[model samples]
Target: MTRKIFKQFFLALVALLSVTFALTTLATADTSNLAAENVDITFGTTVDADLPAGSLLKLNQPAGAIYPLHNSTGKLLSRGIAGDASTAPSLTTDQIKLDVQSGNVYYQVLPDCWLQSDSTVTLLDSTGQAPTDPVALTLKFVDANGKEIQDAKTFDAQFSTTTDATTLATLETELLAIRPAVTGYNLVSADQAEHVITYHYAKPTISTGSTTVATQPSDPVTTTTPIPAKTEPVAVKGTAIYATKKIGLYTSPNFSKATRKIWYQKKQRQNRPQFVVIGYAKSRSGQLRYKIRDINHHSLTNNRRGYITANATYVTSLYYHQNPKKIQVISGHGLNAYQAVTLHGRKLHHYRKGATLEVKAVKTHGLTTRLVLSNGHYITANKTMVIKR
Candidate 1:
């Protein structure tokens, strides 16, 4: 019996040690997985240039890709215009461009500077003046083998008369003497920036130069890094009310002479606010204005959306009305869509006196309590129009 017990204990001890070794090996295993071990890059102000983990980058548009330019007011500045088609400067479809775009801050070349002219390319307003000569941009790079790259990249603002740069990488020129365009950034003053590009290569990979495999100690382990997701747009919150002792609507935020009259005059000073504010903007003079509307009513003015002077109106936090409930139109006829809750107002649609419309909410303006519809049009909640179902 003693001998049998000793044998069983010895076997159990070996099993335990094997399990312990397996667990220890798993605990020390490397999780980082990297494939481009021999590729690297660096750039920007004096910092070492290396691509952020888990990003792919490509430079320059493929040949045969054409892009058009536009003027400030948004007119196409085509290639064939006002003579100088053969001599006027323009970027070819194959012009070299560099854009550093990993995530949201995508550096893209814009055509904001180029202008249209009858004779020559003009300067962009952003660039005070355009230069006659093509700008000079510096470019440097090294391959994966750590060797200087020659003729791999080149750039020019315009054709040089003193030297021949026709065979170079980029040929950029102004449109009718205007500051020309660059990718991912704007020109300084009225001239193009002498952008400096430098590239750093990675260490070369070791090779046996033979078909047969060479013995290696072990493969290095690596972990995979996940890319972050992009963010979505959120809707604006809060509500704006248009109410006061007296109200006058204007064509613009400046309260310009062009007026959009919505009558809401109360004899007594009361906080009877109407209209929900939807948007905010500034006029040319920079006065603040709010986009408010008595939704479901006939919109004020000649337009469907109306704006009011925020400072002159009583602005308040959003107040939720009762949830939409179904109701029947038990009486009345001829309910015209008024631009507002008032009985005397602009007409939107002339409908028969009795029609079943969902009442989304109830809003009060002075003595009138209007039934708000899902589409933001309002109808009077008077006995002549609706009754409880």
Candidate 2:
């Protein structure tokens, strides 16, 4: 009985050990599949490819040839042993060379992605060691077949140590201070190849203050003073005479017994008598008679009663007494040869030169002269030369 129990216990221990080993193998297999190995594919030194873990890449084979890319755990990254010439297996020639000629590389996080840098990118590890995890990367190039190439990978291994929190904060503050600069971030890409235009809003400002000034008032209104009007002086009434001869001022009428007398004698016979007036008068027949005053009288007798020259007497007053000694005569130029005779206190005389002088015997036609006497007698004289006083 002891021998039989020992055999059964042995078998049971063996079975338990076998089951634990299988389970361990299965877990190890799963863990190994989770960590895929990196694959290096080189078309040429100029042609480069980068493959990350947990990704699928495609490769195209030459006609009638087959190739495969696999991880360290024997999982196929690309499949197809050999393909038809018309549809050969293809490998992506797309790759990007970082720090090709220069030592700096730049990239921008696309929209909906997280950024790892500000303006620069640097290759470094989190623990200050070489990079251990595979990085998801993309390259831009044209293949030998002129086909556009890109990496087919998904990973979270891309990192950069150049991102500065202080710089980002400072940039954000400066951008906010810029009136319209924040909108430009949407306009340019990391490569500065893309642009997005947008509008910005702003506000206006103004200043207000006070000032002092000097001013003056206006002048008062003026009033005009009125002036008194002047009156014209009154004119007095008087007489103005326009005379043609030497007129006299007399004190009486009737020249025979006048207080003063004026006579034309000697050389005065050629001049017109004083107060000579040419006008019309009323005759005895009551008709208009044209008359001349201060005319030369003829001496036909020793009396003043002699025939008046036709149309020679005017009825207006003759002023002959103002200058008594002023004589006037028509001929025989002397005053002493004439006589003065009075007829009842009226002078009536004529010129006489050795002839009998009588009122009834006076001749009507003869050479005569007029002599003005100091006794107020105007007599006619014959053959006598009158003197002027």
Candidate 3:
């Protein structure tokens, strides 16, 4: 009986010890998690780091320990903050955002991290210490004719952690102050975007007619001028002429008669005036000109009949000049073959890049130009979208 009681007591002690060990392990795990959550993470200022221009910077953690970075989906981006002075993580990016309320800056610095800023980080100078490599901002000068006036100019534009509208506007103002002036051209509009700055200039029209016309019909001429034989005007049917750029609209075939009534602007490719050709007239100067009537509905020059240059440089046939058996799509995002020439209607099909399509004919309308496929559907004839095979 004594041995039995001793064994039972021993069994009870063993059970108590097992339960205590389990409870201690659970408590320790909970405490460890709490400590991790309470770790004092801090980001130092630029003064604490040795940052080399155009090189990777090594940030010193003098006050707090660095922690792993995570993305929005809770995916780990970095094991910890980078310590290398010569090489950062290959995935580290310069894209960053600034928190105004906390006066802290947040960086991606990792491929997957969507980091948020806290009070630990500080703001750097707006003009100094760019977060990323400088972006190439292109400045293009274009005339009213939609042609480049000169070679495009480019400059490096740097940004801080965040860019707001006011900051962008200020930068634009500073950049515009350096615009080069062109003779006989007045700046009409300056369009500004993040990476592109376009300045459109207009040149005032000057009379090209000679003022030396005979005041008296009986006045003796210095030399006799030979008159050329009369040429019959050629009739055109079902064709149109489009101004490749801005061209003058004349009331008569002869430019010496008067100055252009109006300058037809080619602001939008799809909405430009489409002049329906009726016939071709030879000017007194021996240049052939297109007798056209503007059929662009709702345009300022709509229904206005006039003469335009026949030079292929300034004007082009509304339809494709040559017929091709096949064409290939060149646009990266793929071109949408529409039901009609207009972009307002439903998309018939989408032709991906390098997609070869059979062509039936090329057609044009007031809205835009399109390629009529063999399947009776229309796709864009935009040179940027497709190419003849």
Candidate 4:
């Protein structure tokens, strides 16, 4: 009877000890799922370290269901669907799809969506510093489809020391990086459970294409050419009084028939008085005397040397005659013969219907009273016109 009693007591003690050990093991184990009901998604400036083992933190998204994140410089980091929790938060995947769809797994980091390692983001206090505890971290959530949800779709969750800070920081950084690119989504809420924090991101607006890209420039320089100058006019002078029917030079004292000629010669760099009747010529071989034409300086056909009388007329007037009293038709019409006289400073070269006198004064008479054909003409003192020589 003593042995039996001892065995029964020992057995009961063993059972009790086993039960106690089992209870302690159960209590000490990570019961993250146990406080799921008590876990309230709240926004605080800092996270508390003394939450229950199984406690869960939740986040309430903004009504618009979109969350935007920006750097201190206001540059866009990333954008995608937010608050829909079911999709992986990735630059390549759509975050909004996971929220509405079943069997979707959440991803902490997406390729190409995270900030460059050298960049830093600070979770500030209301004063913009890292708060010690119960600090609210604004998390920008994106779905698998990369659409931005409304602000009401955001999440806010409290974190404690019992919660993993490394994991929380990583999540926070990702959310911050992505928020700036969130076009149609808003932040709903965030929940924390032990070492894991879940973000509920929602979409308020839908978008199709990606953001705009920029362009760059090239290298090397360029150049161009310049222009040239213009040509000047030449001067001409002479004493020969050659005339066409329109332009005539006659004797000074007597106004009578003298000589009728065509061709006239001119020299270069000579300053003759303006409107002084000099020579006569024609525009063509058979044409009658017209007027004194233009005087050209150089001649290309004459081996580029200067030449006169190259252009002449059929009928030209000659005023300088050896015997002025005798009438002579050197070229054309005798009735058209006349004389040029200088009275005072003014010159009267055209004669009246009937005037006869002697050639008492002959001024600078060079060429004989001969008729020569030319290609140009000139103007008379009477204001009669001539063609070009």
- The top-ranked prediction according to lDDT is 3
Candidate 2 residues lying further than 4 Å off, grouped into runs, are 1-319, 323-332, 335-389
- Candidate 1 lDDT, tens digit per residue, 1-389? 69999998875665445334423532443211111111111112011011111121121223222233343233455421111223222221111112211110111122221222212333221122233464445444444454554333443433233332321112111110112122222222221234444433332234667544433324321111111112311112123343545665553455654656455554221224355443344455655565444542443332234456655434432232343365456444556666676646677776564566777788865424677777777766654245444
lDDT of 3 by residue, 142-220 (tens): 9877799767766433333243333333334323323344455555656667767686766644454854332222322
Report every candidate's CA lDDT.
Answer: 0.36, 0.25, 0.49, 0.26
> In what order do the candidates fall by TM-score, top score first?
3, 1, 4, 2
* Cα lDDT for residue 269, candidate 1: 19
Local error of candidate 4 at residue 340 (angstroms): 13
Models 1 onward score TM values of 0.22, 0.13, 0.30, 0.14
User: How many residue-pair clashes does candidate 3 contain?
Assistant: 0
Off by over 4 Å in 3: 1-235, 257-259, 266-272, 324-389
Task: Rank candidates by lDDT, best first.
Answer: 3, 1, 4, 2
Q: Per model, state how many residue pairs clash.
A: 39, 42, 0, 126
Across 290-325, the per-residue lDDT of candidate 4 in tens digits comes to: 112232234321111111221234122223323232
lDDT of 2 at 365: 17
| Maximum-TM-score candidate | 3
